[model samples]
Target: MKTITKTSLVAAAGMAAALVAGGAVAQTAGIATVQPDAAILSAKAFDAANQQIATTYKTQLDQAASQQTALNTQLRTLLDTNKDGQVSQAELQAAQAPNSAIGNQIRAAQQKAEPQIESLQRPATLAQAYAIEQISQKYDAALRAVVNAKKISIVLTPNAIQYAPPATDVTRDVIAEIDRSTPTVTITPPANWQPQQDTVQLLQQYRQIVAANAQRQAQAAPGAGAAAAPATTGKAPQGR
Candidate 1:
């Protein structure tokens, strides 16, 4: 997975703005700046959600880990039938044979673990994206309310500006409004739910671009060529 950076979040915010506003530019007459880093804000939200989710699933995760450990022990014992502390390759092969009862038990244990493993493999990006989406749904209206109350026609992110007076920044106000409106959000989404199509596509493109750039840099790096033969002097009669 590509690392999610502040740069990418800023880019995502810009894209989000374009989509939300239909590419309309805010009027310059009464513009107010908001220095909210979408990435940072999203990260904060994700952290909160992650903590809640972790707490909620702690028992289940623990149980799954314990079950896995027990299964491993059982399989090892089954293979080491001679009680010599180590199983030979032949012993392992025999234990894994199709008709072996131990083999069937091991397979059943693995099958039971599949769902737990899949649950644990939920993508962090997906969770973060969902958290951001929920935050927007809950707080964007409050932000707009602040804008309206302040008679600000335009709200620009920090990325769009060179500099702004501290007084003109409403990021704190926006955050305060969000906190007042929704202190906590749902972290666990419905089973099998997927992120929005556009979000998925955007992330996929971002990952591909990052991967290509990395590959290009690797190829252009010094000493990227195959190892060369050790240099030898014409006089090679000296013994080591």
Candidate 2:
């Protein structure tokens, strides 16, 4: 069977989290600093925006999975002539011969479906990155106001600081300002939009590395029935 695993797609999605968070951190000189996570979590509109993105992509993933499952079933049915419940290496080799009718059909189906399956990975990552950028840009004014009110000269993300008193944290104040000004954000993005070029390139590299590793592991796995030698007869059979 020709298997197109989605390990790379999942790796790309995991990289998106870093990209989103990277945009939220900004360096400034200040007596007080606020954690972006605390502020973002507290904002109801930000939460809603994330939920909307997740729902949309989850539906897309479900549809893609269903389509791929149907295609795999068709390919298996054509190749498993003996109906032994497993497609052995020998059986697969026979089906893939140049003149094999079933083999040609399987190859054709895979050619049509592979691109459709691979296309889902990038957009899924882009949607979340776009949503994060939009929310951060829309709330910048609120965040600035909190900084100014506290007479803070610098604003740093939580990770940048080694230790600080609770009194120096302005996360709650920023959240309150965001809630007051923008109660809810729009979920839909403009047409034909894409994420920043740098982020896209980084994600692509990460996917490639993960995919290479998965391929190596698959190649090293033992073939079916390699674990035990054929049972030996007690003695050679008598001549007929």
Candidate 3:
């Protein structure tokens, strides 16, 4: 029951290989900079969670990597076959047969490993999900406790508010709480514990802002209209 499904094994291995092969980094203006990613990834809780996952899941991961490596070796051998001090046309043609053969080996390996890895990885991913949820919940609880204990009217995640007094950020306590309640042995996110806010509030806010802007624009229209007429002196306003 705990075996890695072949799909999981192959996918996990492929992703790891891709990462190791000089992975492409997306170019986002500020986000691509080393400092932001380093700061986020270096956080103790994040490192702890990922390391814990790796520790619990490393066996299958290693096996997957090993399988992938073997496939790569097989492929390379096929491509480089008959390469003995001279590159010949016959040798080149002969290599195609081996290429086909190597492809078969890799495919077979993927088929076998995919099921095993998936079965194994499902449990780990479930654990990850649970842990993230627990951490977030604990963080919320701690924020509430701190807010109530300190008699503060509000406390928020740092980026949530456009501007708050320095005291409003309860990040330290949140992190402490999150770390303390880290999921012991799970990777799956809780089905009910969605961390992202829903669309209702966002839509409501957008509508309110739009209405206010429309009102302001309407109020200014009379003044603007009286002064500008789109250079009508040259062409009688094109449609009038």
Candidate 2 regions with alpha-carbon error over 4 angstroms: 1-30, 37-42, 54-58, 65-115, 121-124, 197-240
User: In model 3, what is the error at residue 142, expressed in angstroms?
Assistant: 1.4
Off by over 4 Å in 3: 1-52, 68-120, 157-159, 163-167, 180-240
lDDT of 3 by residue, 2-78 (tens): 22223332223212111111223322221111121112222245444555666777775566446544543444444
**Candidate whose TM-score is highest:** 2
All candidates: CA RMSD in angstroms?
18.5, 15.7, 23.7
lDDT of model 1 at residue 129? 47
Q: Any residue pairs clashing in model 1, and if so which?
A: none
- lDDT of residue 167 for candidate 3: 36
**What is the C-alpha local distance difference test score of each model?**
0.51, 0.54, 0.38
Sort the predicted structures by TM-score, highest score first: 2, 1, 3
Over 86-143, each residue of candidate 1 has an lDDT whose tens digit, in order, gives 6566666766677988666656665665455434424444554455556656556767
For model 2, residues 1-240, the per-residue Cα lDDT tens digits are 122223333333333223222232233346666655445434666455545655666656555556666776777766776776556666677776889887877778777875665455335445544544455654578878887776678776667989755556666677678778877767565786655554344333433444456446655776632121111111111111
Best by lDDT: 2
